[model samples]
Target: MPDRPRHYLRQQLRWMRGTTVRHLWWLRHMPLRSLGFWMPVVEYPHLVLALLVPVAVLATP
Candidate 1:
């Protein structure tokens, strides 16, 4: 476990928190069905990308 990955993950989580809050606020005006569609389209990729940070660090020397 290196400082770089920890820093990167922290930064990404901070960004994700802000974006998630903003998106939740925006979603309030939309219909419930839209959540099902948007969750995968927007949220899942962010999650996957965040998860990949660790895998990428592991893959490196």
Candidate 2:
């Protein structure tokens, strides 16, 4: 696990990028029941939420 917020986000982004690329072909060609097809469907939004943490933090007074 990452010790700092920056490190965590970096790790998450790396994971998101790597996963997307690794599964790109499968995501494009695999059926709905396939792991690759479902992975991004769940993961992208989760990653985007992770990316919004800083904004959420900064928005608080």
Candidate 3:
């Protein structure tokens, strides 16, 4: 019973590590210029929403 939790934790960590590595590799290979333009929206999503809300309200009929 004690070993079961340890085994489960190891398996979970392996999965998380693999997922993180895969995502990092993908990001590393992606085009940096396009990513740069969108990075701010990802980093400060509230800013994007603040800018969009007014445009959305004005465009509505």
Off by over 4 Å in 2: 1-18
**lDDT tens digits, residue span 4-61, model 3:** 9888898889997896576566567657667644454364567678899999999999
Best by TM-score: 2
Q: How much does each candidate deviate from the true structure in C-alpha RMSD?
A: 7.6, 5.1, 10.8
Better of 1 and 2 by lDDT: 2
For candidate 2, give the lDDT. Answer: 0.86
The local distance difference test score of each candidate is 0.77, 0.86, 0.70
Q: Write the per-residue lDDT of candidate 2 for residues 1-61, one digit (tens) a residue.
A: 9899999999999997887687777778889987768987887789889999989999999
Q: Please list all clashing residue pairs in model 1, or write none if there are none.
A: none
Full-model lDDT, candidate 1: 0.77
TM-score of each: 0.43, 0.54, 0.45
How far out, in Å, is residue 31 in model 2? 0.8
Best by lDDT: 2
Ranking by lDDT: 2, 1, 3
Better of 1 and 3 by lDDT: 1
Residue 48, model 1, lDDT: 88
